[model samples]
Target: MKKLLIIGFLSLFFAPLAQAQLGIKGGLNVAELTGREGESSSYKAFYHVGVFYQANIIGPLSIQPEVQYSLQGGNLKSAYTNYDSQLHYLTVPILAKLTVGPVFIEAGPQFGVLLNANQSGNLQVGFTEDGQPAYGNESRPATSNFKRGDFSVVGGVGLKLASNFSLGGRLVAGLNDINDAKNLTGINDPRLQNRVFQVYAAFQFGDGRR
Candidate 1:
């Protein structure tokens, strides 16, 4: 079953490559971590840049395959301290798009490979006798406790302006836990998943729109 699925995906991805419109895109990401039981997670601002191939499949349908470098994670606040978790990923998304006039809707599955992770901010060390919190600045490598891969889903809407430029917004939701160290101490949650909202502009190097 897996082999057949892989073969089908490969066929879909590569079949349109020869006649596709090649484009480059760059975007801002408002990213967060979800599924934290008690800790609060806030959106962190980051960026993504990538290249894609889009081709027309039928009258109002198309296929797009993209390779992107995305920075994601969140600002986590707990009772004791607040910190930023930064995660870097190389991601690929294969999308099917439906276009009506100038508007397009797209949805797809995304696969990501984790490149690095880090945390920076102040850590609460103790409480003073008067009940004030004491904090110390800390920066460290946080990659040891996270999984190397992430699976996600992507959905978005965009506008096709003229023939070459476009604008879009997307929501990406992780489908699996990214935490790999269940036994590690001081962990806020045993399961951490990625959540991101992206806004982007794309330019195609072609003469006409698909």
Candidate 2:
């Protein structure tokens, strides 16, 4: 009786750890920035590539961790200026996924570190009576006028095929303000926050399942 109890305890403790999965993934990111009051906003196209792993903790449920390179920010046009601000970040996300047969859905929070940034566009030089640029062809070289860190919320769904390949789409929106808008005049406060839509394909390794 004592030996049987010990065996049962060990099996229960190790069951979840034995079912973990890991995979390699890459994808496209359609990104933009929103929330600059009284200004017009537009989305930009970029690339997002990364890797992910899942640790199954219980029946049909798992914890997923991902690391990826992401492009963020957006284009804005106001009366005085029109430009695109590009930001690059190295980001990590911790997700909780619920798998049901061939389909799974996940949601989580992501943290990111800024890698680089730059701005290019046209800025008007004089007063506008007819909404025309008196002096155009303006540009700002690669600089760090924004913050160094970012945080976002992510959610997505996927379908598993042949226990090997999977296809999915995800939406990530920023929770913290990404723009510092430092020392620059005429730029609005709380100027920008990021938003992205991702479509990805991944292949599972090891046992051909995850």
Candidate 3:
């Protein structure tokens, strides 16, 4: 089913070079991992970049399919230490877009395949609270516990600045757990999921009206 969807999108992507608009986009990601054992998840900053194709189905309505490479993760701050984990994925989103003048809104399902993941931060091995050795602090690379693929839903709004340029923002919420318990990282939550807020600018080729 996933393969068929990708293939269909690709056909839409290449149907007519003159009729459809192609765009390149890059963005900032504010990511957080939810469903923790006890610790509160903090936001981590990352980035994403990709290409997309837009095809109009009717007035003020369109379909867009995008392929993006994204960096996502979360931060953990505790009484003894702090940790930062980064996960990288290749993602695709197929969106139904609606426009009103210069403003447009979009909603869609996104799919991702994990590329890589890692963590690095300061950790307390032992602590000294009362003039005695209680906790030790050291910097090291933490273990990674990540799944191979991720499923998510995305929604956003954008405003067209001109015929060729636009500014946009979106939220992506993971529907599946991106953590693997088999590769247990004692520092990370077992049921890790992705939550990201993205801000982006898009540059489109050819003159396409919104």
Candidate 4:
């Protein structure tokens, strides 16, 4: 059953590419973690680059599929320590777009495969005799403690500035828990999920009707 499903999905995904416009996009990501309790989380700035295929299905409507390399994660701060979690993913989003004039709105489901995860920051070591805090820098591999896959929903709006150039903004809301650790500090659940806001620029080729 899974094999059949995979084959059908792949067929559906690729069928429109032959008639699609190809484009390249790069963007800034402001990402953070959600669903945890009692710990402060902040957005971490990152970037994504990718290519997409878009095909018009009917008047004012289109389907777009994209593959992107994205850097994501968040900053966590506690009373005595600060940590930055960097997670890397290869993400695919199949979006349905509706256009009116030069503006467009898009929504889609995104699938992500985790490539790597890392943690870096300052750790509170101890205190001086005078009660000043002392700290040390730390960095380590964090891949083992995170899930290998992520599912998300994306929604955005954009404007077509010219025949081949456009600018857009979007939000990616993760649907699953990414944390897989047995024991980890500063993470109390509902589990950790990714939340990201993105601003991007795109250039389309092949007749420019994207």
Q: Pick the candidate with the highest lDDT.
A: 4
**True-vs-predicted CA distance for residue 99, candidate 1, Å:** 1.2
Estimate TM-scores for all models. Answer: 0.84, 0.83, 0.80, 0.83
Candidate 1 residue spans exceeding 4 A from truth: 1-18, 124-135, 182-188
User: By lDDT, is 1 or 4 better?
Assistant: 4
lDDT of 4 at 120: 90
Alpha-carbon local distance difference test for all models: 0.89, 0.82, 0.83, 0.89
For every model shown, the clashing-pair count is 0, 0, 6, 0
Worst window of 10 by summed lDDT in candidate 1 = 181-190
List model 1 lDDT by residue over 41-61, tens digit each. Answer: 899999999999889887789
Write out the backbone clash pairs for model 3: 126-134, 126-135, 126-136, 127-134, 127-135, 128-135
Residue range 53-145, candidate 2, lDDT tens digits: 888887788998989988766787887668887889999999999989999999999999989998878754455577643757667655466
Give the number of the best model, judged by TM-score: 1
Question: In model 3, how many backbone clashes occur?
Answer: 6
RMSD of each: 6.5, 4.0, 6.9, 6.8
TM-score between candidate 4 and the true structure? 0.83
Residue 138's lDDT within candidate 3 is 47
1-210: candidate 4 lDDT, tens digit per residue: 999999999987776665579899999999998866656899989999999988978778999999999999999777767889999999999999998989999999999999999989985555678777687788888898799999999999999999889999999999999988654334443589999999999999887755
lDDT of 2: 0.82
